[model samples]
Target: MTNRYRSVFDIIGPIMIGPSSSHTAGAVAIGHVANRLFHAPIKEVVVRYFESFAQTHRGHGTDYAIISGVLGFDPADRRVPLAVDLARRQGLKITFIEDQGLSPIGHPNTAAVTLINAEKEITVWGCSVGGGTIEIRKVDLNGLIFTPQGPLPILFVEANQPIGAALDQLFGENYRRPRVTHQLADHYIYQLDLLDRPFPEQIDQARGMSQDLTLL
Candidate 1:
């Protein structure tokens, strides 16, 4: 089950820092993605750790990693605990649980996370592989895996319409300052009107749809 063109890096790389890559790095990635998918300030979060993550998570700072991620901090930062404190000080309610039965399929460090905000709730299931690399296995309690990171259909127009020098030719004038926000991936979450456009030409839309992007 390996693709020839997929680099070793694809299998083995995710930049992060931690007590343990699986517990710390993976947990952080999960929290970060959940926060983004929700696309709003998370007022409350509950993380349920499983298997190895539950057993050795505390020693590896999994709790702090998840809390920091919910607060928008990267997993590579040494100040993850500080971020947790900052969230608490900012009145974010974060809770943790250790549950072993969530992932009967695979992955030893699986976790189910539920996030709450003023108007919505999001649940994500994820697993942390070694070396801080993480895969967001599912979202919205769907059981189907979906990862928010990387490219997908929601990004087609932005990819085709590059915001900088490329767009200068089409807009009828040279613009020194780039119109950046509209082109950023995160911005689209706030602009739902733009979601239906076809994806970039180079992307294999069918393949992207076939496999659940869940599980890094």
Candidate 2:
């Protein structure tokens, strides 16, 4: 029930250099998505692969896929093969773990990704739903089930007075409304569905955007 509708990318799969959609494309997207949750530059990352991904990740280019994504490469990029070396050059330290635990969601392709910066840390639990589609099940240990439809801007921030005032001033436009919002601990997570277009520059730089927000 996370995704109510399907986008074109769901059926055709993403344009990716893939050994498989679940292993390669999905892993990269997972890492990219995990990175998006952090406001600071990623310094270290830890990923745990489950089931099939845990067994064949290395041979299937899954490791490269994640590293490339953490470095902000999309699935279709040709530089995916060099992501590991590139990460080291960028001062990103990555750790991989193999976990055999059963998934509550019953998906074969699943990962628990933890990303860290100088001050903040974020963890995401997700699964690949085939054809490059993914489901984010949790964030910061709180259930946050959803599936992205397009190139939407996801915002994560603390739900406080300043954040509210800042967001009100920023999203006061006539056409914009949050597609969904979730409260997690002291923070709030939401996604701005752009409906097949790029995000506007104005809202991207809105007054409160940087106060306590992470725009994915």
TM-score for every candidate vs. truth? 0.62, 0.71
The Cα error of candidate 2 at residue 110, in Å, is 0.6
> Model 1, 107-204: lDDT tens per residue?
78887778887677888777775666565545552222333332111221223233333333332232223222233333211111111222443234
What ranges in model 1 sit over 4 Å off?
Answer: 3-15, 102-105, 141-216
lDDT of 2 at 88: 82
lDDT top scorer? 2
Predictions in order: lDDT: 0.57, 0.68
Model 1 is weakest, by summed lDDT over 10 consecutive residues, at: 187-196
Candidate 2's C-alpha runs over 4 A off are 1-5, 141-216
Per-residue lDDT of 114-146 in model 2, one digit per residue for the tens?
888767777777777677766665566234554
Alpha-carbon RMSD to native, per candidate: 11.1, 5.1
